[model samples]
Target: SEPFLPFTAQKLVELFGLEAPDWTQAGNGQLLKESSSIGQMGLLFEKIEDEVVEKQLNKLQESKKMNEAANAPAVPMKEIITYDDFAKLDMRVVTVLEAEKMPKSKKLIKLKVDTGLGHRTVLSGVAEHFEPEFLVGKQVTMLINLAPRKMMGIDSEGMILMAEDKDGKLKLLTPHEGTASGSTIS
Candidate 1:
């Protein structure tokens, strides 16, 4: 009786209670899982409330989101310019007649464009953004009156208008859908 007074696994199995000792297992007086190994200390964390767990999970997700956002690309700085300098250039929407990659250059691409005025050859640093088949039919804005520049041994007649995004991706300046082949942008 004296030995059984204290509740041990053997004494509890023999105790006369409404519930059977074998039906329910109590923690073995340690914060360890029952089947713990000798060298390993297996401790059970208290069951947190569902709301608390959910909140912690959300916080981890938000922290990851912030880190990903912080690692994003930088946006280029904008410059201030006079309207007179801006208005001096003539920009027109022109259709590409032909597009082909340059012979010896990776960044340069040759483009034949119809500017309503005439068909002109324009070279662009746009080999990365455009495919020859896709570019041939796109009506895009261009600096129609730029001084000719030689690229890869070819005289480029004009420059195409392209916008650079924050991620450093170049996008062509295209008119609204159904726009004609040649139109004045100004």
Candidate 2:
């Protein structure tokens, strides 16, 4: 409830049978007669409450920062994508008809693959682990519908997927026993 004891002159006029005195006209008179001394305690308490709210906001922000750091291995900050978008990738099993070391390039191998549909020439950078002669005639998995990338005057139709070995070398991904070329890899 409000402070009821300290009533203004207008309020006192309605409470007590007295005409309100206009301070400007009554020069010698004071309307409030006396004012309530609520004191500085209320003002000081308000400032303390404001500081507590600020500390709570800071604590919440710190907790958010700690949670983000704890989940760093999960890559939580990466952009979200839909499953339909991932399904758009066209991957197929293709037989490596020929493989050869690229001229002047250390890790690049020019491989000609037979995708049951047609022949596609792709320049894969996986020569470090696979010897061209050994890789030939092997059925390897390739991304068939990838955007064509041109390198050394060759238009690479698709990307040949590879895995990273313990030595940090790229190992060509191949299909298991007897999966013929042009097989749909789901």
Candidate 3:
């Protein structure tokens, strides 16, 4: 007859959230030697503990670096350019005759601009920063000679000039006062 142990180590196993260790060898009809199995289990637990500690340390370091970057000062200026290089740009004032958001697009707005040469389509990716209704009748500066490119199935004839601030706020570079459309910017 087999002896019955009334109190096994089940409570102790549950206290450490551990499953009861299996003592049988896998699929070989043999029992695993006890002392070697205990050593291997201890090594596995040590590896898991080391990995958890490393992950927590990395997270803490990343958070500290992010806070430091958020408090940093303004960005450094770009490389200098000469006036002769700047003179190559054919900048002109254009009046927005019509503006509307492009269908099926998130960032594109179709604008009909009067270039003094003629009325032309201008596709600007500034829908998130400016409303279409706010752009109508506004005289804005543009680079007139850029090659026409198709964006969202609309032909963009020119590039509208805008100034972006440090916090990603965009402001179109418009005439301080009313200016004639197609007038060259000196």
lDDT of 2 by residue, 1-186 (tens): 014443444444444333554445454544334653322222211245877899999999888877766654632356877888779888889999999999999989999999999999999888777899998988888999999998998999999887764335666677667786889877
* Cα lDDT, model 1, residue 176: 73
Off by over 4 Å in 2: 1-80
CA error at residue 175 for candidate 3, angstroms: 1.4
Clashes of 3: 0
How many clashes (backbone N, Cα, C below 3 Å) per candidate?
0, 0, 0
Please list the residue runs of candidate 3 whose C-alpha ends up more than 4 Å from where it truly belongs after superposition. Answer: 1-75
Query: Clashing residue pairs, candidate 3?
Result: none
lDDT of 1 by residue, 1-186 (tens): 224443443343333221343323443344344664444323323467999999999999998877776787676567987899889989888999899998887887899999988899998998887777889888989998899988767899999989886446788789877466567777
The positional error of residue 133 in candidate 2, measured at the CA in angstroms, is 0.3
Give the lowest summed-lDDT range of ten residues in model 1. 15-24
Model 3 Cα lDDT, one tens digit per residue, 1-186: 012432333443343344554434225433343342332222212245878899999999888877776776777888999999789888999999999999999998999999999999999989999999999999999989889998877789999999986556789898889989999988
Please rank every candidate by lDDT, starting with the best.
3, 2, 1
**Superposition error at 132 for model 2 (Å):** 0.5
Model 3 per-residue lDDT at 10: 43
Best by TM-score: 1
